[model samples]
Target: MAKDNTTAGIIVRTYMVGALFLLVFYGVIFYNLTLYTEDRNSEKRLQLLSEYYSEKYDLADFDTIQIDPLLTIYGDYSNLPDTLSAQFSESWVGATTFHIDNDEEYSVLAQRIASASGNQTIYFVEAIGSVELDQVDIILFQSMLTGAGIFLFLIAAAYITRSARKIGGPISSLSNQLEASESDFSPINLSGHLPDETKQMLSSVNAYRARIKRALHREQLFTRYISHELRTPLTVIKGSLSVLRKSGNDKTLKHVGLMSTSVAEMEELTQTFLLLAREKLDRDVVAVDEQLVDRLLENFSGLIQRNEVHVTRVLSAPFSLDAHPQLFSAVINNLLKNAINCSLGGKVSIFLSPERIDVIDNGVGLGEKPRGYEGFGIGLKIVNDICDKYGWMFKLEPNPSRGCTATVLLK
Candidate 1:
């Protein structure tokens, strides 16, 4: 269940650790190589000095004595376990011997000088008497290389840490924002060149924020719709029940009729409210079936005739909508019913297009937003809400002749 970022962190940390490991191992190898090279060079220099002494002393005394080049190796050479012997030479005078691996030994260079020699013998003088510049240079070179490697590693680690923090900064900022408040449904306003993963997360968060904002707006409208729609029916129910209790003739029959009408209106309001809520106002999607719109219109045809209203319907052949048709039906039926009430036996014409549905009435037109009345009062607000929900453009303008035009467009 690990996230991609965590997996990436694990991989990167592993690589950096490996790099550090290799750097340390490489530093060790470099130190060993430097030490070995210095030791060998020092031994070569000692042998060269031995040759210098042999040439010097042999020429001074004509003694056929000389020191062997290998025997004069010097510079911390006391640890040489292979150079022990008791033999002395003509060109060597220091016949001091030492034990190597439990065997007595003398310096081979000294053995060569013991047979014959003068004060100029190469004895003890066979070793170097001074240090050389090359040795110092190599030592300094090794130190510089090691120090530079460490410095480079430190700089690289610093860069990595800085880069990681910089990339995670916005993510941390966004996390803080999420944990801060719930009612603050603002858009995520971050400014920076974000990494891809961070950008994707922000995109999802913003999408969720937008959806929640839409839901909240719809809920607010639902509250308003509830207040507006329930008032009339409740008033009717109260008045009707009161009249039935007082009157005596066919009072029961009268009360039943009024109460039945009131109950039906209340039920319609409740069902539509629930439907609007269930949609989550996400009726903003396409794929609305034309048959649903046709069925809704058919359902309300009876109401239009009951109100003494004439209809002129002209719909495009098989055109669909990206909205809820039941909601559309509520909108049109409310408008038509309002026109019927105003026209006193008038005509309501509905024209449908691929993108919009126009309900034009040659009667009482739009008075401002026209939401206050229209009798199916919740219907108008639901219509407007659904229009907003689906991004369907709405227009209410005066008809040049008479009445008003209500145009709802799906753009």
Candidate 2:
């Protein structure tokens, strides 16, 4: 369900429960009050009827009102009190006989009063003349009311149960969907429109998916640069060697030299691709020897010489700490290569210290860092990653000269 609807449902159920409780209390109170008020009025009527009968019959001579006379004088006492009493009036008016009802209370009381007919009068009063039916009716009505209250209670319980299920089922479904979605995975299926929190979560999940997609896209482009563009030169190099066999002339040696150069270019491109491809390498932290960095840099000394870049070193004592060696090399090599490229054949300076290796190149200082474009051409990114993973620091800034200095601090 939608957030608004769920909230509304909860609010509605709360109000319903509140109203139901209030109504039940009111009903019970009113029913009891009706019984009490009716009883009180019945008592008053009994007294009044007794007096009326006394005046007519003048029964100081009678102790109880006869059933026939009571019914004739007061038509109904169904809503009256349970018992009645009065004093016998000796100076009462004449009545040769008294009327009576056939009901059990009236019959029993009538017999008692009649048998005691002397100078004494007997007064008898009762609610509904019939003891059994009045009690039975009250019991039955009360039972009906109890049943009604129980039914209403059950109805409220059912509504609450259903509402809880509605909310829980959707929330549980959303939790499962969230668990299934990963950083790279796309398009999580939330079966229906959910509440606000879930919708917000889905939006965030989608955003995360987009970031991964972009990373994957970048990786694809990186792969393409190696496989296709660089592969062409390697293919040309292979063709040149084969052509040398067929030509057997001065052209052969020239083609052989060209082939050698193409082979070198292919090797460099392969290294670059390999470096970029090491995304998940060194997932576990392991010690990396600092000497390894220096050694790796020495491998590129020949390139450094060819480019006329002065490589300076402050020989650092090698210390082993957590790192990914192959991935780390990508960072170093890229930075070194970029520095060399940007040097414009001016002295690309490289400095190695105890804590870090600095690659300084006299060039256009990263040209405003090339917005919306990021890679390891300058090699610092992979270096930065090494620092990030190892909890170290990597810095890149403009050199005092017209160049840029890239620093990678080892942990």
Best by lDDT: 1
For candidate 2, what is the lDDT?
0.58
Task: Give RMSD to native, each candidate.
Answer: 18.6, 16.8
Query: lDDT, candidate 2, residue 401?
Result: 63
Residue range 352-372, candidate 1, lDDT tens digits: 777777887777665633324
If scored against the real structure, what TM-score would every candidate get?
Answer: 0.39, 0.40
Worst 10-residue lDDT window, candidate 2: 106-115
- The per-residue C-alpha lDDT of model 1 at residue 369 equals 31
For model 2, the superposed segments whose C-alpha errors exceed 4 Å read 1-197, 200-262, 274-279, 282-295, 320-324, 341-355, 361-394, 409-411
Give the Å shift of residue 56 in candidate 1: 83
Off by over 4 Å in 1: 1-262, 278-307, 368-378
Write candidate 2's Cα lDDT for 1-411 as tens digits: 544344435655675678688767866786667556554554555556666665577444322344453353321223223432122233343222221333233311221123333433343344344432354676687678767877877787677667665655566665566676543356666666577886787678678877887887788777876577667867776776777767768777766765665586456546556554555444544344546666766766666666666765544455444555555566667777777656545766555555776777776685653233344453455566556756778788887868888887764
Give lDDT per model, in order. Answer: 0.60, 0.58
